[model samples]
Target: MRMVAVIAAAALLTASACGSGKNDTPPPATVEVFTWWAEGGEKAGLDALVARFDADCPGQRFENGAVAGGAGVNAKQELTRRMARHDPPDTFQAHAGAELLDYIDAGQVEDLTAYYESWGLRDVLPAGLIDDLTVRGKIYSVPANIHRANVVWTNPAVLAGAGITTPPKDLPAFIDNLAKLKAAGVEAPLALGRDWTQLMLLEAVLITDLGPDNFAGLFTGRTDWRGAPVTKAVNDFTTLLGYGNLDRDTLDWPQAERLLIDGKAGYQLMGDWAAADLEAKNFPGYGWFTFPGNGNTFQWLADSFTLSTGASNITGTECWLKTVSSATGQQLFNEAKGSIPARVDVPSSGFSPYQQSAMTDWKSATQVPSCAHGSGCSQAWQSAVNAALRSYSTSPDPATLQAALAQAATQFVRP
Candidate 1:
């Protein structure tokens, strides 16, 4: 079946170029695809996509340009440097929403509205997602998958040992469970990682304390940052931080996930990508629940690929984008990545249990974007929030953190 698809793709590639006088120049031999999927489940997903690219575009080599970091924290800095030097990769991974605004504003990424029309993507991709990918009526990237951010991955055995039969439904209940887990000999009842992971936890707590509408409003200036609800959320976040590991400042999400996988911690609040990692490592009896107080809401983010404005290999880059936007590519990538396909037409028959549930929730739940994952706000706004979080992590002062956040909104949030 795979071979047949490859042969068909090759025939289509040949037929499409036959009548065009523009085919005088041979296509580039290799396409350098840049991303931060350097390890664990993220890497597995990228590997699957690369395999699909190899099969579908047999003439073009797939050059891996992966940089290591959680949430592309390090990779974004590297990408900035590359872009400044006018050496951007053929295509690079980016978050699908407000994050792409930076590149779009700078004219660093090509307008992909034409590509979307040509590929009939508007027919298959969710309308909400296409809207998220657009800025000034032009889409700049092709989203690969939709990841739910408000998930609490659990070690079921650890919870059972702590005398907790069911997952917590609210912040207070969750805190109580943490206490029980700690009393039952768990070192860190909540496993947390550095900057963005901590930010993700805070966002989940925001959803709990403010509700989905209010939390989403925080990004759009519809909700005030100085409101009592935000203050309460921050306090709740600080309280939860106390139950996390002391080494959190030094670790990334994958290390924090290991704490739960090894039973040293009771839960890890993360995106559904953790499911892929747990499955990859063959960790048994792992379970998941929506983060406490986040019922019926899906806090979401999308990983997307953008074609550079002056990409050295337009043919190779378009080939990569086409493969990424296809249902087959989305199926292979999302199944391995523990995300649901961005394309609504992709079937959920063989996805993991967590992904299947996520797909259902994706359709019915109230959806909100993730600030930590760059969907809810601009990169500058997210950076300002992260700065506040870094200071709060060390000082544990809720008031100071709240002040910093309000100030960030003043500086960055548009009317």
Candidate 2:
């Protein structure tokens, strides 16, 4: 990987020198940035990157290719169709690890170790984020932003209404508080979308409260899914699901956001980016707490761009990756994206208070690639988790969900 980066850097230097020596007119290239960031906080960040790229890389037109869906659902499916037809965008978004792994397997991405090395990322990028982007010592993607997933967005009024004084610090207390809210006649203790968002919320709780080391172990094929810790997480998630609104299955994150926006729900466990949407709604005076956990460590996932091999324009595509991962670009991108840049060296002045706090927690913590959320686990495991938990929208059966979780945990060991 280091050798590939060295050679690529040398090649870029040679190309730059040779190009600089010539007065030959180069044609402008059209670059398309495909991503699942078409609304609220995500849209802002995507626009910021495009604007910066347009300003710096003159004549490089960015095709606005934003698809609306949770966890890159529509975009990933769209990418498959494009790759099949040999027609992919100049750049597209992916969660660093498993998503990129699939593309690398299909020979659909460029090795970005050179770009990473050129930016001196070994020293500047956060180690956790770097590890997530790397596979077998090689890098295939550029991290755009660190989206911390373990936040519990709470409505202060709702919590007060339920007579809960402070955020719960452990799983047992956490569950008890939600029960309090439910008994207080709160329609939803957790403002869940009752789809993948519910699953994401559950994973956040399990990872943060359960200890990141134990959380990491689960996916690396070390932890036993049939055991108490994993079972507790399943039960906790199902119990939270026990407090959901009957119509949750139809709600997207935004609709769920609206509930918190209107002070209709007591708490919603989601990423910090959800706060960005709250900010946009001019919703005021809400509180965000780390999903109460036994440990103080945090876990995160990064959203980044992966160039498709089907890109017909290499120069444009190369430049796209180069500028997006640049220090200035990372800052601008994360600022608009409602998160922080993956680069550790970037100044932290341009973010909101919630983002600033999340960054502080992020600095002191560990990060793991989000398996079910971003890693694009196997279709079987994803379906199993979905099938197992989907019923929780109404059922909330712990035993049934636990059995399903145990069965699905077997899917991740690559060997």
Compute each candidate's TM-score over C-alphas. Answer: 0.90, 0.88
Candidate 1 residue-wise lDDT at 187: 93
Q: Per-residue CA lDDT of candidate 1, range 166-225, in tens?
A: 988788999999999999999999999988899999999999999999998998789998
- Evaluated at residue 301, the lDDT of candidate 1 is 94
Q: What is the overall TM-score of model 2 with all chains considered together?
A: 0.88
Worst lDDT 10-window in candidate 1: 19-28
Pairs of colliding residues, candidate 2: 45-336, 45-337
lDDT values for all models: 0.89, 0.76
Q: Which candidate is the best by TM-score?
A: 1
* Model 2 whole-model lDDT (C-alpha atoms): 0.76
